[model samples]
Target chain A: MLRGFLVLVLFFLLGEALQKVFLIPVSGGVLGMMLMTLTLMFKGGISDDLASASQGLISVLVLLIMPGVVGVFFTADQFAGQWLAVAAALLGGTFLSVLSTLWLMSRVVRLGGGKGE
Target chain B: MARVNDWYSRLLSLPETLSASPALAIGLTFGAFFAGNAVFRRIGRPLWLPPVVLSAVLLAAVVALLGMDYKAYQQGAHWLTVLLGPATVALGIPLYQQMHHIRALWRPILVTLPIAATLAAVYALVIAWSLGATPEVLASLAPKSVTAPIAIGITQQLGGSVPLMMGGLLITGVVATLFVDLAARWLAISDDRILGFALGLNGHAVGTARAFEISPTAGAFASLGMGLTGVFTALILPLVFHL
Candidate 1:
């Protein structure tokens, strides 16, 4: 498990180095995830070490992100005036996007001869 | 009454010792999270009762009530923030496990992922812009569909406010996760893959977590959608919204 975590951290560091070198706009962690996915694909399977380590991290994924969410308290006052606009945009936009994506993906799947089940 | 007042005074003075301790910060965070999780589970895990949401509210309330500055809390809680990158990288495991499915349906996923991502961003920008949101807010709202880390990076690159972007991301995740079931039933969408993809594309990490509760296959597809959407948004947003 520790080895697997070290490997993940290595990948994340590599991603950060690559991002700095190439000036990629994406976050290094995301780039690292993409890189790890490719590595696993080519390797033909997930190692138990990696699998267990990742599972441990993924289980508490929400906990990891909570710090940033809590940071919102620092800037809550900024949105006080635009809360209505922000709320409308977030709620309205998210609803429409989910609805449309579902509709489009299903249509495309049906067209491709899959049951889309 | 006098003893109660002394206890209250002692409680107020506790921050003097506890405020600077990382252990206290971490302990408080975990305690709040577990408490929130207990409440959420006890309440049967309603859509609006996400553990992170509850925990955030709880933590914020505690900080405010204790009269502790946000920065002081952040200083001690910084360790959790450091793990965000690794947690994101760990997402690759699920994506890897689902590789065969992804390859089999690459045609549809490849075709639709970009379109779905673009539609999400465009809808957000248009709605916020028309509603008279300021430019900074517009930039932040534009990336609300992507996961929080990537969204924050995109927002920074576009010169938007990070805090506003975080708020937008949380709201987007909660709303999408909450309404996705109803939207699917209304649209007659029984395909778990499509539903999962839609959820991840719109809701990001939170939605993907919700998708996992439904099925592994759904969870896998949702992770793929989320990863691809993040990559696409990161690549495209800077080009379209050049500073």
Candidate 2:
């Protein structure tokens, strides 16, 4: 447990360092993840204990959305009053995004046409 | 008693007959989500599956009908809010398991992460600004593509309204999900890692969920993307928005 906490702390610190030294646009923790991931790679793979601990934390990552869910409680009124604007924007955005992804997927398949799908 | 009424009021605060419990308020909020998620899944609606959204809608409706303030509802909702850190810390596990796979692609991650992060951050900012959004809102909207908890914190740090930031981020996540693959397809984007990671990094949980729907490998990339993007935004947003 202590190790996991320490590892997390390390990521936090390293994330700060990477930004200062490397000029990366992404965060230190992310850099930390990249760092951790790299270390795991260097080791050839994670130790079973490290893997287990990491996995345990990842399991319920979804529940973290709860706090965010609460955030919407405040935005509800703005949504109600100008739903058309929200709807129009979200709808337009969703349409453009999905269409673009599907198009890419199909093209990829066509290009890989030589390979059996 | 007046302080309670004035400062941190509960939704079910009855004046005549008093039942002073925050649980009831939280139950009402969660019950809406639980029920909405159930109904949406059963009926098989597109928007229903992500109960986070549906729950938000239902909670709003209940509050409207009850004449409750967002703050009042928050008395209970705050409990759920506090759990975000635990949830964030928890993401380390799946990431740990995927370490071997991620390790094999370190060079690509190092090279591509910066490029993708720059593009996503700039793109959102340009769009929001071009649309005539104010500076503070632009900062909030800029990080919308990443996951919620981190995005929320980033926006708040940068001086955006937390709730507005949350709404913007949620909408961005959903919008990014619907289009990332299609956008990549349009650009002739072929590498799943490039396509998946870019979207996951930019779109956050919604993007990751969509990636998971496509493939486990893609999902792994998506997770990496979320982890990477959140980390980047944590560092970068403060710099960009703080100024």
State which candidate has the highest lDDT. 1
| Residue B80's lDDT in candidate 2 | 58
lDDT, residue B202, candidate 1: 86
lDDT of 2 by residue, B126-152 (tens): 555555566666655666666776676
Q: Which whole-number lDDT from 0 to 100 does residue B223 have in model 2?
A: 84
Please identify model 1 stretches exceeding 4 Å from their true place: A113-117, B1-11
lDDT of 1 at A8: 89
- CAPRI-wise, candidate 1 is medium
- TM-score of B-chain for each predicted structure, in order: 0.92, 0.81
Please, what are the lDDT tens digits per residue for candidate 1 over residues B1-243? 999999998887887568778877778788888988998998898887788788888988887887777788888888887777887899899988877777767778878888889889988888888888888888888898888778888888888888778877888888898878888889888777877888888889989999998888788888888888999999998777654
Q: For model 1, state the Cα shift of residue B193 in Å.
A: 1.2
> How would you class the docking of model 2?
acceptable
Candidate 2 chain B, poorest ten consecutive residues by summed lDDT: B11-20
Provide the TM-score for each candidate, comma-separated: 0.94, 0.68
